[model samples]
Target: MSHPDPWRTATLGNGYAASVCVTPDGDTVLWLLAHGGCIEVDDDYGCCCTDCAPHEQLNRPIPHTMRSALDRPIQPRCSRPRSDGQPCRTPVARDGLACHWHRTTKETAR
Candidate 1:
């Protein structure tokens, strides 16, 4: 028997977002976390990453559209493994939380 894959949560401007694997190896997340999550194959496939694994996990596609300079808390605070068969690297975003393998975005790092 199989178990529900381990999951992780990311805090967004609205609330919490959860991400889980569906295919166990399909290279993308199943979009089980939040309502606005990107599920379309094309929309969810690309990574705004360097060390990100070939597999694409659903990322919070929402961008900070603030008209003024504001701060936001990072998500995940680290990368979690997916149910997908192969391995992947932790995600690193500009303003988001620090994952196991990524660095703070240069803008904020200063």
Candidate 2:
């Protein structure tokens, strides 16, 4: 019997959603959302629930034709200011206020 595809069945409802999908390049990724915001977690971590086993097996890569539909045109930029007092041009890390460099610097300073 063929296994069910998680990406096809994943739904957004009740202010929470989660899914495992494959990129066009064959990399598997997990997307999660809660409370109207995206939930970002470390790459090494995963859901501990027993129900995740079946969904995790569905890693069929997305088609290239679907890339544009999935891509975000406007992403949040880093909020840190440059040396000349201009806003940093780098994109912010997923669900973060600053880019990787600035985020690390800020965390180390605290």
Candidate 3:
């Protein structure tokens, strides 16, 4: 007999079937069926398992607006100007509104 793949969908003791996989840290994650045939991942968030991995697992559906926000283009240009008096075209910091050089210079000046 051929062994079944652990990631394959299996009967979960109901009409529901889900694919379960173990993460690198050994957390049992289940891709369960939600409403309207949408698949949702169950990372045992409601369970009392103490050894559950700290990494976030998708268990809820994200709104279309929020999902689109992730796909929105990031045009992070530096706020400072160049030596010719034109606006800087360098990319800004991911964590802040300023670019790397401007942020460091401002910090050192304080």
In order of appearance, the predictions have TM-scores of 0.19, 0.27, 0.25
Residue pairs in collision within model 1: 24-84, 74-96, 74-97, 75-97, 78-99
Number of residue pairs clashing in candidate 2, backbone atoms closer than 3 angstroms, sequence gap of 3 or more or interchain: 0
Error (Å) of candidate 2 at residue 102 is: 0.9
Model 3 scores what on Cα lDDT? 0.51
Best by lDDT: 2
* Per-residue lDDT of model 3, residues 1-110, tens digit only: 01123557676665555665555565556666433434444444332221232222356455556678888988767757556877667775542466766665644221
Per-candidate local distance difference test:
0.37, 0.53, 0.51
Tens digit of per-residue lDDT, candidate 2, span 1-110: 12224655366777766656455456666656445343433455444222333333345554445556678467767757666878776875444477776765644221
Error of 3 at 27 (Å): 73
lDDT value for model 2: 0.53
| Lowest-sum lDDT 10-residue window in model 2 | 48-57
* Models ranked on TM-score: 2, 3, 1
Off by over 4 Å in 1: 1-6, 16-20, 24-32, 36-110
Cα lDDT for residue 48, model 1?
Answer: 27
Candidate 1 local lDDT, 4-28, one digit each (tens): 2455444455543444444435454
